[model samples]
Target: MTVIVRDLRTEDRDDAERFARSRHRALPHLLWTAEGTLHLLAHTPPAARRRALVAEADGEVIGTAQVDLVHDSPEPGQGCFTVYVAPERARRGAGTALVRACEEHLAAHGATKLFAWVLDAPAHRAFAERHGYRAARHAHFLRLDLTAATLPPLQPAPPGVQLRPAAGFADDPRPLFALDLETAADEPSDVESGSAGYQEWAASTWEHPMLDRELSMVALVDGVPAAFSLAHTDGRGRYATAMTGTARAFRGRGLAKLTKNASLHRARAAGVTEALTGNDGGNGPMLAVNSWLGYEIVATEVRYVRELG
Candidate 1:
């Protein structure tokens, strides 16, 4: 059987569903949906030069890749591609074909450095090394059984504080945008990503289909948005915390835990059965908060880097 790589058909719903299915099978810890897939394709900034790729074998998609340049980063010539093949279809040449296509696309766009997140399994790590990539930072995917875990009881807000849902900001989401920008700038990563403009953030994050506005909890300190937990639900009983952080000034008050715990509790009440999140291995504070929330590490992935000649 011949495996061929091609660009994903953005206008085709069937194509998007197939792509999302392959990705979900390869990485089960994260949430994926066809609508979310299309949102990324349509909402990504033009400068990103994002390309959605798929590997077809016997008239079916067996692997997928999201390739793009780091447009918001201050540094130039940096790009990334995350490629994954369905677990049941491994070693069928689909993965290698998709990787070659991803590299060609990024390099053509002036990428001097390329990075990828490879699963920490032995075979996955060996595949990255064979492709001339070296492992760098590690991260973990954490899971919580929302339906079975004993969640902490909800508590009243502390003095001068209030817990609100992100949906309350629909009339004007600029405050959430500002908070997200500040926290994202401080997130640990191998590549330094700069902040996105309000318009960009709205399109790529706030307005995305998967963002669960009602379930995402935000903390208000004297009416100012200080901390928030961004939630994404797949409409299939699966929910993930896209990001959870507190403003710099509110760091020591345990607001991060406060917001996330509220979000998870509401998510369970809303019929969400599983909760997922990811954290950089070096981010001890967030990791600790997840631990307090009863999250357990389910899988790990390492960021691999490759430099072009």
Candidate 2:
């Protein structure tokens, strides 16, 4: 029997949800939803040429591949395809078929360099190496059981400091942007992420479909947004700590932990059962914070990059 790979139909909600579920089981770190998966297909820039491809076996969706160009980067011909098959369905050629279709589509659009993230597992890494991708940066996926873990006690904001929810900035979020840019300037990553323009950040972060502003905690110093714990939820009781950082000028004050704990407490109180977060392998301080908050290592993923000729 042969696997049939084709573009996903927006009307096929059940099939799309299965694809998303397959990805979640394979790699739980990523944030994905059927609505979000479909949104990307509809809203991604034309230059990106993004699409979601599903592999069907006996009329059942068995795999998903997200193919797109690196349009945000200044470089050209940089395409990427992240393929995930139901773990139980591997070795049936669904992964290979998805990758082949992605390569053909991107190559036709002038792609020479491709990037993909593979788990550090022997089999997954071997699969990527077989396809010419070399390992790059590695990151960790951490988790905390909100209902059972012991969270750090809240500390009163030091003199002149305050703590609040990001929803307070519903009218103006530029201050939060400044704080984000300041903290992101030093975030550990294989690919140096640039500061997205404020308008774009508003569109991508503030207006993102999954953003939970009420759960996003922000630390303030004399009325200035200085640190924050950005939160995202899947609307199904799963919470994720997206970012926790303090401004460079305020680094040693422990404000990041302060806001993060506040957010976590709020999440647990609001019925969020499981919380997820990720830390760069080399980021010791952030890792310590997560550990202190009862987050444990659940999985690891390695990033792979291939240069374009």
Candidate 3:
């Protein structure tokens, strides 16, 4: 069978659907949707040089790759890509071909270091090693059965603190943006991510199509946005926490846990059955928090990196 790699057809719904299905099959704990994929393709900053690529074998979409530079990272020349093949279609050379295409595209865009995520499975690690990528830290995808698990009871807000839905900030989300900037800078990652301009964050994060503003919770201390738990939904009873963080001064007060717990309760009441989140293996505080919320690790992915000569 011959494998062909090419850029995704932005206007093709079938193409987008197939790509999203492949991703969900490969990493089911996280949310995936055709509309979200299309929105991402259209909203990505131009400086990122983002490309959504797919692999075809025998006229069927078998694998997919999203390639782009770490445009907002404090460090330059860093490229990132994630490739996943339908489990049944593995070893058809689709993964390899997609990787080659991603590397070529990123290198052309001046990327000197390429980072890829490989599932922790043995075969996946071997494939990455064969491509000259070395293993790095790993992250876990966690899942909670909102229908069965008993979420922690909501607690009264601490003095001067109030719980609010992210929707309340729709008229002016600048405060959330500022909070995101503060929290994102502190997130644990292999690459040091930095926030782009406010407009860029608005297009890529705040205004995202999957963002469920009503389900996303925020903790305000005396009218100041202190912590948040962002929610994203696929409209199919699947909900994922897009991000959860607390401001520097608000870290020890259990504000993150409070907002996230409230968000989960709201989501469950709204008919969301499955809630998903991902955390760095080194983020013990968050890992403990999710465990307390009854989330279990469903899958793990290792970060792999290679330096381009």
Candidate 4:
């Protein structure tokens, strides 16, 4: 039985479903759906040269890879390829084949540095090290059982601030875009970030099929978005905190917590059964916020870096 790696067929629904399921098994922290997987393939920035790949042996898909360049970063030539093989098929060289294929494709596209998210497990770390990757910053995968978790009681909006659904900005989402970009610029990360493209933001964010505007909540001060909790739902009771941040000027006022709490309550009201979010392990403030909101760490992953000359 030989395992071969190949590009994933974008139009094939079964392949996408299987890929998502395999990822779910490999890393339960992520909330991925077939549609979401397809969207990444269709919507990733062109400079990224992103591609989804599947590794098969005996006609069964056993591994998956999401390879792409970091197009949004100010620094160029940074790429990423996260490879995962189903536990049932490990040691079959499926992971190796997938990583090799991804690296070759990315290098062909002029990528100089590569990053991968590896689960914080001994074998996972060893695999990355064997491939010339070194562990960088760590991140936590948090989960909340909305069905049984005791969330903090919804608090009244502060004076001069109003809690509003993201739908309020449907006619014009530029405000949300501006708020997002500001928060992203201040976000904690190894790589410097910027978010200036309104058109790209619309295409990659506002118009995305998985984003749930109704469940998303924003804290408005004088009718302007000051902080927000971006929401994404998988059409299944699975809700994710895509982003929760406050504008720089709004920091230290508890607006982020306020907005996120509102979004969580709205998610529960909308029948979302599970709430999932991720935070950089170094981001103590946000982690504290999540803890106060009843989230518990479920899994952890470390970012691995590799430099190519």
Candidate 5:
């Protein structure tokens, strides 16, 4: 069977949906939807030079690749790409075709270093190694059964701290942006991410189709946003915490756990059956929080890097 690789036509709903379905089938641990796929393509900052590629087998979409420069990183000439092929469609050269196309695009735009996330299976690791990529950091995807798991009881906010939903910041989300920027800087990763500007965050995160402000919980200390848990829902009974963190000054106060627990409670009350999240393996604190919330490690992916000449 011949496989053809081409750029995704975001304007075509069928094509977008097919791409999303392929991603879900290939990596069920992550949350993805047709609308969310389109939003990423549409709202990606121009500086990232993002490209969404689809691999077609005969007339069906069988694989996808999200390729872009690490525009938010301080390092120059860095690019990141993740490729996923439907389970049934693996070993048909679809992945190779997609990677080749992605490399060519990134290389043409001056990317000297490339990073990819590959499943920790033998075959997946072998594929990356064969492509001259070396393993780097590791991360895990966790899932919680909101319908059955016994979540910790919600605790009242500490003195001088108030818990609220992210919706309260609708009129002005700059505070959330500030908190996100601070937390993201401290996240463990191979490539450091630069600040996410307010305008960019507004378009890509605050206005995202999957972001559910009402289910996202935030904790304020003396009327100042100190910790937050950002929630994303697929509108189909699935919920995921996209991000949860506390300001540097509020880290030791257990605000991260407090906000996330509140969000989970709200999600469960709203009939969300499953909850998902990912954490870098090196992030022990976050992993401990997820563990306490009854989230089990469902899958692991290894980050791989390749140096370009």
Candidate 6:
């Protein structure tokens, strides 16, 4: 059977659903939905040169890849690509085909360095190495049984600080965007992202289909947005923490912990059965927060890097 690689047809609902299904099967710890997938395609900035590729075998989408340049980073020529093949379709060469197509597209866009995240399984690591990718930083995918696990008791808000849902900023989300920009700048990662402009943030983040503002928690210090936990829920009882962060000045007071815990509680109350989150291995504080919340390390992935010739 010949496996053909082609760009995903976002306008085709079936194609989008198949792409999301492939991702869900390959990485079950994270949430995926057709709407969320389409939102990514529609909102990607033009300068990013993003492309979603699918590998089709017998008219079935068996693998997918998300490739794009790091547009917001100060450095140019940096690219990111992640490939995933449905578990049942592995060993069919779909993964290799998708990766090759992704690399060709990225290189044509002036990408000098490419980074990919590979599941930490032996076979997955070997496949990346064989393709000239070297393992770099590691990250963990944590899971919490929101329906069964006992979460920490909700703590009273600190003096002068109030825990509120992100929806409270519906009229004007600039404050939340500013807080996100500040925390994102300090996040531990290989790529350094410059401050995201309001228009960009509105299109890509605030308008995302999966972002559940009602369930997302925020910490307000005297009416100022200081810390927040961005929540994303796949209409199917699955919820994930898109991001959890605190402004620099509020870092030491456990506001990050406070916001995340409050969000998780809200998620459970809303009938979300499973909660998922990811953290860079070097991010000690976030890792500690997840552990304290009874999250288990369900899976791990390592970022692999390769330089284009």
Predictions in order: lDDT: 0.94, 0.84, 0.93, 0.88, 0.94, 0.93
Assess every candidate by TM-score: 0.99, 0.91, 0.98, 0.96, 0.99, 0.98
Model 6 residue 217 CA deviation (Å) reads: 0.7
Error of 2 at 213 (Å): 1.0
RMSD of each: 0.7, 2.1, 0.9, 1.3, 0.8, 0.8
Kindly list the per-residue Cα lDDT of model 5 for residues 211-293, writing each as its tens digit.
99999999999999999999999988999889999999988889999999999999999999999999999999999999998
In model 4, the worst 10-residue window by lDDT is: 187-196
Q: Assess the local accuracy of residue 159 in candidate 6 as a C-alpha lDDT between 0 and 100.
A: 97
Give the Cα-based TM-score of candidate 5 against the true structure.
0.99
Instruction: Compose the digit string of candidate 3's lDDT tens values, residues 1-309.
Output: 999998889999888998899888877877889989998989998889999998988888889999999998779999999999989999999999999999999999999999999999999999999999999999999999998999989899999999999999989999999999999888789988676689988998998989999999999999999999999999999999999999999898999899999999999999999999999999998999899999999989999999999
Ranking by lDDT: 1, 5, 3, 6, 4, 2
List the candidate 1 regions with Cα displacement exceeding 4 Å.
none
- The runs of at least 3 residues in candidate 5 whose Cα sits more than 4 Å from the true structure, single-residue gaps closed, are none
Task: Estimate candidate 1's alpha-carbon lDDT, on a 0 to 1 scale.
Answer: 0.94
Give the residue spans of candidate 2 off by over 4 A. none
Question: Which model is ahead, 1 or 3, in terms of lDDT?
Answer: 1
Candidate 2: pairs in clash: none
What total of clashing residue pairs does each candidate reach?
0, 0, 0, 0, 0, 0
RMSD of 6: 0.8
Better of 4 and 6 by lDDT: 6
Q: Please, what are the lDDT tens digits per residue for candidate 4 over residues 23-92?
A: 8888777788898899878877787788999999998889999998777678888888889998988999
